[model samples]
Target chain A: MRADGVLGMLDRWGRSALPGATLLFFVLLTLAPLRAPYLSGALPLLPALVVFQFSLATPERLPGPLLLIMGILLDLLLGGPGAPVGVSALGFVLIRAAVVNNRRYLVGVPFLFQWFGFCLLALGFVALVWFFTALWTWTAIDPLPALMQYAVVIVIYPLLAPLLARVRARDPLNVPDASRGTARPGETTS
Target chain B: MAIRDDFEVVASQVRTAVQRFALGLLVIAAFGAMLLGKADTVLVEHARVLALDLASPVLEAIARPVAAANRVIADLKEFASLREENARLREENVRLLAWQTAARRLENENERMRGLANFREGPEASFITARIVGDSVSAYVRGALLNVGRKAGVASGQAVVTGEGLAGRIAEVGENRARVLFVTDVNSRLPVVIERTRERAILAGDNSPQLRLTLLQSVAGVQRGDRIVTSGHGGSFPVGIPVGEVVETGEGSVRVRPFADFSRLEFVRVVDYGVTGLVGSGGPAAPAAPPAGVRVR
Candidate 1:
């Protein structure tokens, strides 16, 4: 009985850690140096997609502090040659806050609707980065790269979203499907 | 039931308030990081280096397979163009043969002149080769992370080059990794002279494919296809290293196409030319001498 209980505890721990681990995986994937032309510019969008999907599907799993840590980790791993240390962290925090607050409207929605919402979020995210980078460097950077990245991210959303949804579905500890009009597992309906 | 409900409501209120406070604090911390990074303080540099060192292993492991796949794809592309490439090479070989003969004659004359003038050769440069583990190529930044660092005698301010020409210089160094600031980065600036006219100018990168030739003393003398080479005016780079070729000359603007291909770089050589004092102050007390059995040419 004790062994079974220990195993169950471990299983719960692993399940609970899944979302954060997936986020970190996406962060590493984004930072991986794939030499394809213009692919590096578009790769940073992968983590942004993961963050958005998680916030919408399971906001409690990915809390504000966890998002902040992942974002800062990304900024650090990108090294000094890219944007300053906190730029990505800032972007991630704002993205989670935005998506979680709007989760009610976003959940249970048609895939296309979620995608449209993501498009807006992505634009705002990219613009925030571009603006912060410009202000940090004190120069009018070329907007073409930012625009190209945004376009690529938008194009790639449909392909990556379903994969993220699959991960969310696999989580045994996941809250009740919000689209089904049920309250989340821990919430009091009153 | 009523007492339990009241306690639950209080707990929920506390949780929400705590979450909001944490979010606000994180937002403030992010802004603080940006400021610290902008200040470019020692603490920030240390953090950046530490982050790079920690990530290098993972980056290298991931890069290997991607590099292999890239090679296979490149080979496939090259195989497709084999016949056309062979034909082009044959034509170029014939043209180059004639130039080779002329160059041989010039070399002989130059040797005699140098002998007569008693020209002394400069110190031979030593270099360490490093494979690129990470490429942070974005619209705003063009930089790379190398797998070699201080342990291998790599240091900041050393000129990095690929087979073609000058790529960039070392910007930061850790125990086992270093960051390269590419020549096409917006922060890159080099003093160069036109090879044809020997006119001096400053080569500046604006985060674009083509670099701009600024501070030209004789703009009228520059034309299409003029080669640009390092002037070594700033003591950061050695003199006479090939930089780029003029691609366009317009009203008050001239563009030079860099010889180094930034997108396709895999390995680079960090050359110690024995010149220092331009970039960061930290380096080996003695110049990095080439290890034994390594050629120093």
Candidate 2:
């Protein structure tokens, strides 16, 4: 029974290994140099996609602790003026938990709820985290531009979300095993 | 049976708590690493250097093809609008032709009288041209990397200029890549002289397009349309390089309209101001030019 809890968490996330590939894609893309000579205020949010993936499929896998670590790693790796990753990651955790825990009301709902929720969560995470951390770093006054740039991330979300959903559907881990006595509730198969 | 269930629940709670504590420590550790690297740490510097080195090749590989594709798309779009573009170009050409005539006359006159003036007294500067291959990926940073670096005979403190005027100076140097801290960065400061009055002031940027001239004791002496030039106070930049023109703002602070077009910087010159003076290996005396006895009548 004890093994089941740990194994259940693994089984849930292990289903869509696509998040791992997506994370790598984003990190490399972010680390990769731009092909132009002008600055781009827009940044592709690979981490936010990770949040959405786990939120929709395996909420238990993306625990509070992992989100926090991912956030810190982001801050360190990106090395922005402020430590924004921490709060953003926390936002992801809270948003995911709220949506998953309240999945009953949202059941049988169309994709719009998921899309809108993810955008708000991602934007709010970027804004709140960037706003506060920037304040700490004495550069907090520039929130307007940050918000505008985050809107770009939101605009690109709907397009990216469905593709991720398709990838998640094809994962073998998402396949239901009826023989595992009393399949856990709310685990969607198909 | 009840006691056994209680024990299991307590054990799981402890495990969760332990995991949380470890994560907390990791967060603190990351913060510590940032603070430790506040000023000149090898690890942070090494990582930055490695990132630049790694990204440059990627940038170089993609830059040409992307630019070419953009050009092709632009050409296709312009084909539908060529008639309008042609009219604009013709008008621009007429204006440029008039300016070209005046420019040619000035150049001839200046060259004829150049031998008699201070032209022979100043140290000559030479530069290597480089292309801007990549832009700052991080939003807070106001700089870009060029393919030229220390290994390419580039050095720190070398001033980079576009065709219009001074762009910025090389801040960091890796093997094949160097970062240029633009004049619009908060930390950037340049000693500039107003060409009209020869009044010296420090031009500083706060990551804004409008750069302020600091330490202006008498605002009355400075006026709009005054040309700014490098004062050569810090020796980082060459004297008389065109900086920008002054514009008076309503806030009572003077802003400079940068001569270089930051929006469309493509090719730049890396002024390799010879480091002979810095390294104590002063080169041989400047090559003597036969005295130009020509005097302007």
Candidate 3:
């Protein structure tokens, strides 16, 4: 086989794993030591941000299964009294749902508009997490953390938006393929 | 070619419909997961342990370079202050040595008195040194991840500390990693005693740098700058471990600045005082909350 063909095979597999890998990166960052006491009020919602970035930019690359899996992964990693299980995953899906539908309009707007859009989506994300936690624990989840997390997400979105823009532009997974043409359970004749 | 274009359009519509359906199902699944988590804690606990076990190695890998970089920075700062620090340390050492002798005599007298009274120990403690791999210094939760875990017999409720003072207790222990709930976590409720007055209070964390001394027997007579130490009320922590000093003493609000610098934490000692059954029965619950009477911060 030609070297290009072998390389192409490797590229395809990498592309297949890219969405999962990207979501995982956000999960890993959640554990980084940022010991600033003031900053502790709101942990950065990196997974939600990543999901929003991708779903807006490349919906086909990020399918529902991967989104759900990444959310579950985040919940499992961060589960305890600190955060309710499945909250982050649900937050990610919520962000994806919001972003994917309005992506076309968001794609052409100025960077600031996009940033604001993300901030809005991130607020909903935090709210989703807060809602789930409140429901499960039978206590009103403290709104301070959720509020702080949203503030941080908004403050840092501009700095991160460019990176997300670059990823959307260059993501191999975003390439049109069978992923976009995926059929439902059974619809051979249309 | 026309047929192919028509097929593409049909496929796109089908894909969109399927994707929306999948999203709906995922929302349900996420809700289901939370419901299951609330209904069945055992499964969540297992998953938490497994996730932490898997995360430990990755956290270690992530911390290596960052730790090295931090050391480089620390070395530079130490070098910058070497002469002044050395002189200060020498004077402090002389003072500490004199106090050490006095402490030994006091310890002897206390042991003799306790022996006469037939006092039983709370829980014998042993410590394991570990690295701070990751920490979430966020608005809601103050958690520190340690590189050492179950392999080192590190368990939840073990007091994590530094040379400076008491940091927090282990909240969750994985196979090779443990998350330390800083004394400043909103959920942290420590049973502490004022060293000078012997007044007992619950040093609770409200997600701040300083812990609030809640459930105080009397806000009165608690002087400013008073030393606070673990009372070992529940036996999870060893008694007399320096927790913090009174930093604020308003009538309604009192706070203690924790001895440990949680923000700059790197390495720590996870001391399991063997309160095994007293509190934290191999679970994430911290020592019982102080009986209700004091106002929360």
Choose the strongest candidate by TM-score. Answer: 1
Model 1 vs truth, CA RMSD = 4.0
List the DockQ of the predictions in order.
0.56, 0.19, 0.42
Q: Write candidate 3's Cα lDDT for A83-179 as tens digits.
A: 5677777777777787767865565557777787887788787777777666665555468766867887787677776686675554433433334
Model 2 chain A worst lDDT run, 10 consecutive residues: A172-181
TM-score-based ranking: 1, 3, 2
Residues B1-297 of candidate 1: C-alpha lDDT, one tens digit per residue: 999999999998998798788879989988887887778767777887887888777787888898897788778888999999999999999999999999999999999999999998664567787888887676677788888887777878889988889998898899888899888888888888999898888999888888999999768999999999988886657788898999999988999999998877888888877665223476544456545543233
Best candidate, DockQ: 1
Q: Which of candidates 1 and 2 is the stronger one according to DockQ? A: 1
Model 3 DockQ reads 0.42
lDDT of 2 by residue, B178-267 (tens): 778788765678898889888888998766666889876667788888989999887657888898888774455888888987766667
Model 2: colliding residue pairs: none
lDDT of 1 at A84: 73
